[model samples]
Target: MSLMEISCIFPVTDIKKTACFYVSKLGYKAVEYLECKEAHICLYRDKTEIILLQAQTKNIFPNRELYGYGYDAYLYTDDQEKLEKEFLEKGVKIVKPLNVTDYKNKEFVIEDIDGRWIAFGLKIKD
Candidate 1:
């Protein structure tokens, strides 16, 4: 079966606050923000779209817990350095510094406003 586009839906405490972070810090635009009973917002950046849904509780995993409680998001991009620089300048908490993994992947990880682990990586060249 052929698959189309796949986007993420993250549960957050507040949609406006979370949406603002993506817009101001991560360079995402708020495509849709519904402030009804179920607060929700949709952010768009380049060809990617992320949906933030207001939830009652949070399920953020600790940095050390990399096993069962997995990362909330894992993303790949070509502009790794540019994104790292931008995130650093914005005072974003880069949990892990950019480095080459033993698996030969050059990547870094960052935590979002909702405490979700978002990892970005790029393939390393020989």
Candidate 2:
């Protein structure tokens, strides 16, 4: 079996803020907003898609724990320089700055408002 697309679901504390961040800061477009009491914002960039689900449950877990014990998502891009510049200019928190690695690519890491890790990279051409 072959995979068609991958969608990461992130539990957000504030739906509106998270939605805005994805749209304005990350440059992702909202494909559809599910009509439900609990807000579900569906966003996509090219083929990659993500769903931001506002947690209706009254669990008092920390933001990191609520989203998942570890990283809830990662976004890979071919335009590393442009992506990095845009994110930095927008004042998005950069967990790791852009750097070229021996592994054969230039990459950087940034965290969304909700603390989700987004790694942008460009493959090195020989």
Candidate 3:
């Protein structure tokens, strides 16, 4: 057997709003959009795929902070610096600025409208 692709699904308060953000702010394409009792949106960027689902029931906890966790997603990008600058210009909610971690990755964190923490980064090679 062979493993295929994977898509991360997030429970957002509003699918349309989140999709717009992903499309405009994060540079993703709306592959599918659906609204009903439960809203669902599928976004694609290059080979990456992200899905946003309108949360009906209450979540176990609020954002990652209140949940005592962090980093809902780690988005790997080759052009980290340029993308970070673009996000800043777009006034994206940055949880943290770009910095080299001990693990040696140049990375920054972005907070979505729903408070999901997404870390975007690239490897720092010596």
Candidate 4:
């Protein structure tokens, strides 16, 4: 069996605010399922999908906060410059601009409304 595309699941304190951020700032379309047993908001943009779940606590603990240094998600993209430019124009909070990492990946990191760092880029070939 082959694995398909991966989707991110975020636990946010406020689903509406987080959904708004994804829609307004990050160019995503959102649909809420608040009436369900597990309330969530599904954010979709191109091939990316993010499910925002209602957090039990007021605060979220991202991987960086727990592990000291780690991105919550890494999205592979072929056009990093264009994506970065679009995000910049849309007023998205870019924590790290597009640059080649030491690991040889050209990527840019953006901080979401809940303080989760999401990187977008692809690894360079030698």
TM-score of 2: 0.76
lDDT tens per residue, model 1, 1-126: 899787898877777888999999898989665747766788888878898887777564444475656567778888888889999999888988898888888889998887877888878888
Better candidate by TM-score, 1 or 2: 1
lDDT of each: 0.82, 0.76, 0.82, 0.94
Per-model TM-score on C-alpha atoms = 0.83, 0.76, 0.83, 0.96
Candidate 4 residue lDDT tens string, 26-109? 889998899999999999999999999999998899899999999999988899999999999998899999999999999999
Could you tell me the lDDT of residue 58 within candidate 2? 42
Candidate number achieving the greatest lDDT relative to the actual structure: 4
The digit string of per-residue lDDT tens for model 3 on 1-126 reads 998888889887667887899988888998655745555788998878998887776552435667677688888888878988999898899878989998999999998767778899988878
Residue range with the least summed lDDT across 10 consecutive positions in model 2: 58-67
Q: Which residue pairs clash within candidate 2?
A: none
Per-residue error (Å), model 4, residue 107: 0.3
Q: Where in model 2 is the C-alpha error above 4 Å?
A: 37-39, 57-70, 101-105, 122-126
Against the true structure, whose TM-score is highest? 4
Q: How large an RMSD does model 3 have?
A: 2.5
